[model samples]
Target: MRKEEKPKIDARLLELLACPLTKGPLVWDEEKSELYSRLAKLAYPVRDGIPVMLPSEARTVDPDAEPARSARSRRE
Candidate 1:
């Protein structure tokens, strides 16, 4: 049996998306299935490839804690 793959948000859509509050860029976190807004200090959940952009639905995040991928990329 073939393993089912998790649905992912389109790259183009991600590029076009921004934080509703700050209108700042968002970073995709595949593992957590969330979009992090650094400027807003929020982590928006992505469900079944659809991003939940509503501020009420978003979870607050620590401003000092960087996403794993972002931290790794910064090392290179």
Candidate 2:
């Protein structure tokens, strides 16, 4: 028998996790389907349903226009 690997965050967990930068509520962008921090103006990609909270793993939003690629990408 094999045990199923569960997601790092479940529905309840999602309710608890907030934006590290803003300390404000985050919304799940169903379109990009990524966890977005509006206050932080960053979008953290959820890989395999696991949100990478690291700032390095995040993409920044251009306050002027639209969301742009993060200037600082995740270092190895």
Q: Per-residue lDDT of 1-76 in model 2, one digit per residue for the tens?
A: 1335433335566678888887776666544646667678888887776888888899997667443333222211
Tens-digit per-residue lDDT, 1-76, candidate 1: 2336555667778778889999888887776778888878899998777889999999998877757554311111
Per-model TM against the reference: 0.79, 0.64
For model 2, give the RMSD to the true fold: 9.9
* Candidate 2 CA-lDDT value: 0.64
Model 1 segments more than 4 A misplaced? 1-4, 70-76
- For model 1, what is the C-alpha lDDT against the true structure? 0.77
In candidate 2, clashing pairs total 0
In angstroms, the error of model 2 at 50 is: 0.4
lDDT of 1 at 39: 77
Displacement of residue 41 (Cα, Å) in model 1 is 0.5
